[model samples]
Target: MTRSATLDVLIVGGGIAGLGLAGYLARQGCEPTVVEQATEWRSSGYGIGLWSDGLAVLDELDCLGAVRQRAADPNRIEIRATGGERLRQTTIPPDRTLLLAVHRADLHAALRTAVPADWIRMGTTPARIRERRGGVDVTFDDGRTETFDLVVGADGIHSTVREQCFTEWTLRDLDTYVWSLWVEEDVDVGGDMVSVWGPGSEGFVARVGDRVGVNLAARLESAPEPPALDELRTLADAVDWQRPALLEETDEEPFFDRVREVTCERWRTDRVALVGDAAHALHPIAGMGASLALQDARVLAQELATTRPERVSTALDRFEARRRKPVEREKRKARVEAAVTFVESEPLRRLRNGVVEHTPILDLFVRQQAISG
Candidate 1:
């Protein structure tokens, strides 16, 4: 993959990781084709918090200004009880790291626009992937077979590329369901990111400019199919503040899904590799998914751009070796946080609250999360 050689690269999944990688590679003089299953760009989902590391990647792509224009800067993060009593609060020091709360759609749009339009092929996916001597052969859903010097899977947790090329992978169900939506109605959040936790449930509310974004998560014995509006209302009954307005403004189709994590012992083969959620999907409670994806894009693009075609496998190895530690650490942190925040036992919940109220546990957690790795 020398700068002069035209290394044909195919990136699966056109989400944040894929697009970010494509943009970086293009800047390095490599043209990568991205294939997404969606027919058109999806402007869905609630908001995401981007720390300095993610912002740095956007700046490298020359899209930081575009993202900041549509994003909201939050100076504080607050944790509250069900009755709106603030248990802990931490201020985001601008001198340290920056935090921006932007809708998921806006972030996706910014990354998508940074990549060339023709580099993406929508409405189709790779049907089969076969690794050869120095390259990989990919068969698309449209019955076309093509060979590329390298194939990277940024597809996501349920990645087809991972399933086809690798065997030691599992999608661990977290036994939790989440509902998220963004509404234009005003809610009193004081322009801060606020999270409320109740027994077996947690809700996050953040003001993105004039609109507000809400995310609700609850632990369950089993994951169910998409629930009806009435069922969602019942779930919202756990939280008091802004529930009425959030329910009333809920769209006909809101984001609802089971939370799962992807764990893979190996993220690459001879000519194929995985990045972002495809390799290691963490619990959403960690709020590090998008940031990790951006970081993975930067590292993988760097490895591939500088290596030669004959040693593409070594490049893939270097990419995984550099990224696996931070990703695994965050995965463990997310699981621990989820366990503490979503405790169903009344006694344990009270003990957890007491510890959080008296100690600086929440503040420490925020600081740990602020580190971009």
Candidate 2:
């Protein structure tokens, strides 16, 4: 491909979305600079299930092999009652394409390696995004200012870019709190993902390569807030099978956060645009968050690559139009998944479990998330 003239692009956040976009834009002859507020790039999560759609994006970026080398098979997911009684089992649909479970840090490292290190400016973030006539002038936290042809906000849920550009967008709390941690030592998790359902709470254990990841979710009657790790252990003590041991062995500090979904009136305007979690943060129940974000990076790069600098706004519109419907659908389905996972009443939980086991519902969901994400 012939290189086009440089269209100075500034990408906020050095996460997957930003790095992926930077790699793609650089290939398209854009001098893209990524600014991350952290002293170094980092993410708080254990294993992530990368469906075929997500792998396809990585494949396009030529990083699938690297990620696959460190990934594990997400072959089966089991749902069980708090007492360890098996409720349902869903076999991930067979596909020619790969479905992988990988540590978030491994995936991040893969994407980071794809981009030039000098292109990333760690410990730097825009304190102000001043909109110019046809571009944006960003004032960095270090008191440096620069103008760019386009500014892409791949920042996360509490995005400063979104706050500056799309002030109308709001993060809608799902009244859920989550705690996730990884075991320091390898645990024999049998290469399958398990979710244990309890009253107002749910716990999950997934095999991430040699190690195991434990995550807990609770539905709160009031606003969501992070609970202490000991409180998490107390809650996990009621769960079945190896969950208690898994929780106990997680010696590291757990990742705690409120579950939130972003509602944006528009994903882009003027010279500014939002992608990934900054544009739409879905409930984690769906397991499509990273997949969708990588998809956003690919689509955004595709749009910008084909359009001229003067027509950037049109490209942004096309990007949003193509992504919004599928994402909204995922969000809707995610809500249902959350409701079932966090069901409080025993009778309702039994009913939900029965429906999931006896019906083709799970297979369809699995296919949709794998193929459509």
Candidate 3:
């Protein structure tokens, strides 16, 4: 492949990671083609808490104002036990700790508005990707073939690009299932993010925009192929606070999935690269997935823009090197959090609760995780 003045980039998956990278690359004068499998924009009907890092990325993309208009500012976080015993409470100052709880659809819409409309190809997917010496030859599901200077697999955990390029990648099941949903009702948590922990299960409730968002997680022996709402309801029964209202709002089909972490030996191969969940799918318990995805977009865009098109491989290597350490650190923290939140042992749970109640560990953890670098 001959060197070009501008890099022609192809991004798979049009979700947060793909769209965010597209937005950054576009701002750098790179016209990136984004292919999304969905025919239309899908609303997740769930909320995500974006820390300062995520907000900074949106601000750089000039989408922060729009996101703020659709987001809620939770002033604090409250952690409690199954019997409604307060374990820890941490205050989140807007100036100090920037945490915005926004609906997933709203955040996606903000990112979508940042990119060129024509750049996104809906209902499209790549059928084959062949990496030649110069560029990657991609065959789309619609039988269209295109060659680009760079191909990015920002397509979440089960990325086709990663599957094709990095065959050694594996997904580690966390032996947990999560259910999340949003309801149009008031949840009086005093404008705070409330988390209720029980044996082998946990629940979260927060006021997002004008709706109440609820997330429930439970530890299981094996992955449930078809998760039943009744089983989720049974887990909800284990908790007292926020049970009745959350159960009342639970739909027949809420967002349900098994929690899995993506582990890969490498994030790049020649000109093909992986970003976001495609490279490292951290457990949602860390609340860093979206933020890290945004960070990946920014770093990868910077590296590619600064490097010559002929040195695209070097840029990708730098992108991976810059992201690997922090991502791995967060993954470890998420695993620890999962253990504490879903511990089944009575004595261990008591010890964890006692430590949280007495020390500033929760506050320090939140603050530490909120920092981007």
Q: Looking at model 2, which ten-residue stretch has the lowest summed lDDT?
A: 222-231
In angstroms, the error of model 2 at 241 is 2.1
Q: Top model by lDDT, which number?
A: 3
Model 3: lDDT equals 0.85
TM-score of 2: 0.94
| Candidate 2 off by > 4 Å | 1-4, 92-98, 184-186, 221-227
What digit string (tens of lDDT, one per residue) describes model 1 on residues 4-80? 14678999999889999998998888888999999998777757878768889999998788888888777788888
lDDT of 2 by residue, 72-113 (tens): 666687777777777677775445544687778899999887
Candidate 1 vs 3: which has more lDDT: 3
- List candidate 1 segments past 4 Å from native: 1-5, 94-97
TM-score of each: 0.96, 0.94, 0.95
Write down the lDDT that model 2 would get: 0.81
**Which window of ten consecutive residues has the lowest lDDT sum in model 1?**
222-231
TM-score (C-alpha, index-matched) for candidate 1: 0.96
Model 3 Cα lDDT, one tens digit per residue, 42-107:
877456778888889999999999988888777788899986789889997667647887888999
CA-lDDT, candidates in order = 0.84, 0.81, 0.85
